[model samples]
Target: MMNLAVFASGNGSNFEAVMEAVKSGAVQGEVKLLVCDKEQAFAIERAKNHGIPTFVASPKKYSSKEAYETNVLKQLHENNVELIVLAGYMRLIGSTLLHAFEHRILNIHPSLLPAFPGLDAIGQAFDAKVKVSGVTVHYVDAGMDTGPIIAQESIYIEDGDTREDVQRKIQQVEHQLYPATIQKVIEQITRGV
Candidate 1:
C-alpha cells in the first residue's frame, strides 16, 4: 500500500476527510505521518485521534525555510512516506521539497484554477463575479498553485451569493475531490498507470 504523509497548517478539516477515506478503505493507502508547520494546529489532534504518527517542523525554528523543510523531509524519509498530501498546508513548498519527492506531492486548492490561485480563492472568485468556481487537485510544483492539473470540480455560484456561501460549497467539493484524486494517484502508483 502507498504510505502517505499528510501536511496541514490549520483546522484540518481536509486532513480529517482524508483520514476518514483511509479508514473506510476508500483511499487504498496507509497514512504514515501527519506533519504540520504550526505547533498547535488542530491537524495534530486529528492525527492523534486516528492513531497516526504526527510531527511539527516549524519554519520559525530553523534559520531558513529550506532548512525547516529539510527537517520535514528527513522525518518523512525515516517514516517511509511515499506520497505527500497537502491538505490546507499554507506554506509554499520549494524546489528542495519538490526535488526530494518529485511528482509524488499533491495539493488540494479551493479554486478551479488557474482562475483564482492563491489565498482567499473563494473571495477572489466572488469578486471576479465568476458564475462558477470550485476545487482543484494538482501536482505540486515550484510555483504557487500553478502545477499541472490532476482534477477539478466546478460549482455554479448563484446570484448574490456571499463569499462564505461560495467557500462552503467549495469546501464540500474539496472534501470529496481530494480523497477521490488521492485514490486515483494511488491507483496510478500501484498499477504504474
Candidate 2:
C-alpha cells in the first residue's frame, strides 16, 4: 500500500477528512504519520486517535528554515513515506524539502489557484468581490502554491458570503478533492500514466 505522511498546522479538518476517506476506502493508501509544526495543533491528537504516528517539529526551534525542514524530511524518510500531504500546513517549504520530495508533496489550497495563492485566500476573494472561488489540489514545487494543478473545483461565491462562510464551503470541497486527487495520483503512478 502507498504510505502518506500528512502535515498540518491547525484544527486538522483536512487531515481528518483524509483519514476518514482512507478508513472508508475512498482513498487507497495508509497514513503512516501526521506531522505538525505546532505542538498545539490538534492534528497530532487526531492522528493518535487513528493509531497513526504523530510528530511535532517547530520551525522556530531551529536556527534556520532549512534546518527545521531537514528534521521533517529525516522523519519522513525514516517512515518510508511515499507521499507528503500538506493539510492546512502553514509553513512555506524551502528548497531543502522540495529537493528531497520534489513532486511528491501535495497541497490543497483554498482557491482555484493562479488566483489567491497564499494565506487567508478566502479573505482575499471576499475582499476582492470575486464571483467564484474554490479549491486547488496540486503538486508542491519551489514556489508557494505555484505547482502543476492536479484538480480544481469551483464553487460560486454567494452575494453575501462572508469570509467565514466562503472558507467553510471551500473547506468542504477541500475535504473531498484532496483525497480524490491523491487516489488519482496513485492510480497514475501504478499505471505509469
Candidate 3:
C-alpha cells in the first residue's frame, strides 16, 4: 500500500475525512503519519484517536524554516511515506520539503484557485459576491495554491447565502472530493499512467 503523511495545522476536519475514507476502503493507502506544527492542534488528537503516528514540528523550536522542514522530512522518511497531503496546513512549504517530495505533494484549497489563492478563500469568495465558489485539489508547488490542477468541483452560491453557509457547502464538497481525487492519483501512479 502507498504510505501517506498528512500535514495539518488546525481542526483537521479534512484529516478526519481522509481517515474515514481509508477506513471505508474508499482510498487505497495507509495514513502512516500525521505531521502538525502546532502541539495543541486538534489534528494531533485525531491522529491519536485513529492510532496513526503523530509528529509535532514546532517552528518556534527550529532555528529556520529549513530546519523545521528537515525535522518533518526525517519523520516522513522514517515512515516510508510515498505521498504528502496538505490538509489545511497553513504554512508555505519550503524548498527542502518541496524538493524531497516534488510532485508527490497534494493540497486541497477552498476556492476555484487562481481566483482566491491565499487563506480565508471562502470568505474572499463570499465577500466578493461570486456566484460560484468551489474546491480545487492540486499539486503543491512553490507558490500558494498555484500548482497544476488535478481536480475541481464547483458549488453555486445562493442569493442569500452567508459566509458560514458558503464555507459549509465548500467543506462538504472538499471532504468528498479530496479523498476521491487522492485515490485517482494513487491509482494513476501505481498503474504508471
Leading candidate by TM-score = 3
Question: What tens-digit string does per-residue lDDT give for candidate 2 at 74-178?
Answer: 899899998899999988879998888877899999998999998889888899999999999999987889999999999998897777888889988998989
* lDDT, candidate 1, 143-172, per-residue tens: 999999999999999998888889889889
All candidates: TM-score: 0.96, 0.96, 0.98
Ranking of all predicted structures according to TM-score, beginning with the best and ending with the worst: 3, 1, 2
**Candidate 1 clashes between residue pairs 3 or more apart in a chain or in different chains:** none
Give the Å error, residue 65, model 2: 1.8
Off by over 4 Å in 3: none
Better of 1 and 3 by lDDT: 3
Instruction: Decide which is better by TM-score, 1 or 3.
Output: 3
Per-residue lDDT value at 152 in model 3: 97
Give each prediction's root-mean-square deviation over alpha carbons.
Answer: 1.0, 1.1, 0.8
Candidates in order have lDDT scores of: 0.92, 0.90, 0.94
Q: Per-residue CA lDDT of candidate 3, range 72-122, in tens?
A: 999999999999999999999999999999889999999998889998999
Q: In model 3, what is the error at residue 193, expressed in angstroms?
A: 3.0
- Best of the candidates, lDDT: 3
**Candidate 2 Cα deviation (angstroms), residue 33:** 0.7
